[model samples]
Target chain A: NAGVTQTPKFRILKIGQSMTLQCAQDMNHNYMYWYRQDPGMGLKLIYYSVGAGITDKGEVPNGYNVSRSTTEDFPLRLELAAPSQTSVYFCASGLRGGGDEQFFGPGTRLTVL
Target chain B: QQQVKQSPQSLIVQKGGIPIINCAYENTAFDYFPWYQQFPGKGPALLIAIRPDVSEKKEGRFTISFNKSAKQFSLHIMDSQPGDSATYFCAASPITGGGNKLTFGTGTQLKVEL
Candidate 1:
C-alpha cells in the first residue's frame, strides 16, 4: 500500500529559512503524527492530526506547524528555522488513535545552519 | 520530565546470546507499552508491545516482560542474530486520551557480533 511516504529524504536550510516536509499515506488512516528524532535519542512529537482540519500541539511544537487537509496527507512546516531544529523528522499514520498501531515513513533528515 | 526512560545507550552481544533492553515509565495512566526497531536510514517499526494487564508477551524470537508495580518493561531478543541489530525504542501511551500520543525513551543501539 506504500504505507506512509515522506518527501525530500534529506534537506538543509539556512537560519530564518522555511520549508515544508510533505507526508502522505495510502492506508487512509485517520490519525497522522509528526515526530523529530535527535542523535542517540528517541522521537519527540511535534504535531498531530486526528483528521483533516483538526490539529494539535505535541510535546515539542515550537517552530513548526502542520496541516491535514486530507486523510492521506499531513505536512509539517518549519518557519524561521534554527539550528536547534536540526534532526530527523518522521511522519506516521494510524487507523485509530490511542494505543493503535502506527505506520511510519522513512523520515526526512533536516539540517539547519 | 522524561516520562519514559531506557537504559544501556548501546549494547553488544555475541550471536546466539540473549540481549535484554530495559525501559521504565512514570505515568500511571499509560496502559500501552511498545518497542520499536529502527535500522539505519529507515523509520522505526513496531517490534512487540505489552499492555499493563499482562506480565509478558512473546512473538517469535522477541519477548516483552512487564512489571506493573515498578512501571517497568523490557525487551529480550532470544538467540540474537546480526540481522537483529538495530536501535530499539520504548514508548508508552494512554489508551483513551491525548490522541494516543506516545512518549518515547532514548534509544538503545544493539549490535550482535558473529
Candidate 2:
C-alpha cells in the first residue's frame, strides 16, 4: 500500500535555494495534491490538502508552500528557487475529491537553476 | 485565462489511427471529466473518466466524450497503440469544490507511430 509517496527522486535548485518536496500516503487518503508539470503544461494545482490541518490555494500558488502536518504528510516548499521553478513535481492522493481514484507519486524532478 | 483548453498541441497516430484530444472548459461548474496519461518520466496516470451525466465513457480503448452543454471534453484513442505514445491530459473538476480540485488542460502529445 505505498499508494502515494514522493521524495527527492531528483532536484537541483540554485537561484534562491530552498527545498522540501516530500509527500507520503499509504491509502488512508483524504485528498492531498501538489502538481506542477510545465513543458507542454497540464497538471497545475500547486497545493491542496483536505484532512490533516487543511491546506489550500491551488492554481499555481505562487512560490509554493504546503503542510498537512500528517495524515501521511504533505510537503512542498520551494521558497525562491526560481527558474520558473523548473517543473515535474507531482504528489497526489485521493479518497474524497475530484473524481476519486487519484493516487500518483513516483515523480519529483525539480531543476530550478 | 486558460481555464482548461487543450487541443492539437501534438499528435501523430498511425499504429491503428484514431487519436483525438480536444478539451474545453470555462467552468460551467465543471462536472468532473478526467483523462491523464504521461510516459517518459512518469507521473500522470488516471487514464479515463467522464461524468457530465455521461455523454460517453468507455474503457477498453480509452474513450471519454462529454459535452455538457458544450463546456466540452474529449479524448478517444481507439486502437492506436505503440504503447499509446504519451502525454495526454484534460481535466476539470467542480463537484462543488472543497477538495475536488483539478482543472487542467494544455497538453496533448501523442505519437503512436508504427
Candidate 2, B1-114: lDDT as tens digits? 788889999989799888998888887877788888888887888888888887998999888888778788788888898988998888888877679888789788898988
Q: For candidate 2, give the lDDT of residue A18.
A: 92
Q: What is the lDDT of residue B16 in candidate 2?
A: 88
Model 1, B14-49: lDDT tens per residue?
999999999999999999998999999999999998
Error of 2 at B96 (Å): 1.1
**iRMS of each prediction:** 0.9, 8.7
Docking quality level of the chain pair in candidate 1: high
Every model's DockQ = 0.84, 0.32
The candidate maximizing lDDT is 1
Model no. 2, DockQ: 0.32
Reference-based lDDT, residue A108, model 2: 91
Cα lDDT listed for each candidate: 0.95, 0.86
lDDT of 2 by residue, A1-113 (tens): 87888988998979998989999998888889898888877778888988999898988899888989789889999897989889889999888875776778988998977
